[model samples]
Target: MSNLPTINTDTIWAILQDKISDEVVNQLVWSCLGYIYDETKQAWDISKVVDDWGEKYPEPPDFIANRPPTVKLTRSIPQENKQLLKEKLGFKGYKLGEFGPRETRRATAANWLLSYLETH
Candidate 1:
């Protein structure tokens, strides 16, 4: 994986939804996707990315920048902290434990989305 801080959209699909909150997934996905598209001169669909990601994220957050977002959920977010996470990443579609296909705390959330959200 490219580790230049500019995460590729294709590389971040699974990272987007894997047992994470919608806020974290969206931010990380968008930030990485932004690098792939806007920074590295690649072309892709943000709307489709978001949609393909899952219905949990009805839409990307309003604070998104023209460039990818800088806040990375994994590295930055502490482990096993619900309220703090809610304050930071927002508790939109959060769940406990590892997620399963067609079986999750949040029924609307998609397990495959994270896997497909990546570009490369």
Candidate 2:
């Protein structure tokens, strides 16, 4: 059988704790999903904003630009990786019912990562 890549929870936790905040992660999730925070409306809305990896679109705004280059920003985690993270991190669903309305998988994952860092 082939060897599987190892995940270092301690290192991942440390990065989450030291490099980024839950709020910023949430914003990054939205950015990855093609949404932008409208300061005037005080809400997130669908926009043409591009992520760091988007070469065809315009440059990322400050909210996305200011993030540490090492942070992994994506629209969604692949199923296998998500399962691996859940198993290693000992967490449940990405949905956070206590926080109110349901969020996208990406947002929920971001929120969960931050929550895990905060509580653990």
Candidate 3:
């Protein structure tokens, strides 16, 4: 039910494997678990816990930020048109459907392209 991002246990385990001592990991996990399960606190902050851990120890690589950007080619394009677009645009680092802040020209252009495709 929480809107917060889910923590990856596998990544945590990977980081804990050889980076930090078992005692430290156990202590941090127990502290966070206590805050989460405690009847009165009614709050949890995995990010904060991880950040603190990173401050005291080696930081883990940020997995989410490392994911490659993807774009949805929303329409059926003719080979000629696709090649033409590629030639003109040099298709790189574009995420078609994932527009961020519609005020930007790139986002607006993508929106216009989608609308144009939908109409055709």
Q: Which of the numbered candidates is closest to the native, going by highest lDDT?
A: 2
Q: Between candidates 1 and 2, name the one with more favorable lDDT.
A: 2
Model 1 agreement with the true structure over 15-95: per-residue lDDT tens digits:
334444444444444554332234464443355443232233333432222121222222222343323323433334435
For each candidate, the alpha-carbon lDDT, in order, equals: 0.33, 0.40, 0.31
lDDT of 3 by residue, 8-117 (tens): 33323332233433333333333432223234655433444322333332333222122211122213233344433234333343366754332122222233232333
TM, every model: 0.21, 0.31, 0.19
Model 1 weakest lDDT span, ten residues long: 105-114
> Candidate 3, which segments miss by more than 4 Å at Cα?
1-16, 35-120
Pairs in steric clash, model 3: none
Residue 21 in candidate 3 has what lDDT? 37
Error of 3 at 40 (Å): 21
Reference-based lDDT, residue 24, model 2: 51
Root-mean-square deviation of candidate 2: 13.0
Native-to-model Cα distance after best TM-score fit, residue 42 in candidate 3, in Å: 25
Q: Model 2: number of clashes? A: 0
**Where is model 2 poorest over a 10-residue stretch in terms of lDDT?**
1-10
| lDDT by residue (tens digit), candidate 2, 1-120 | 013112135534432333444345444434444655577987655455444444432333332334332133322334444454456666454444543222333334444344334443
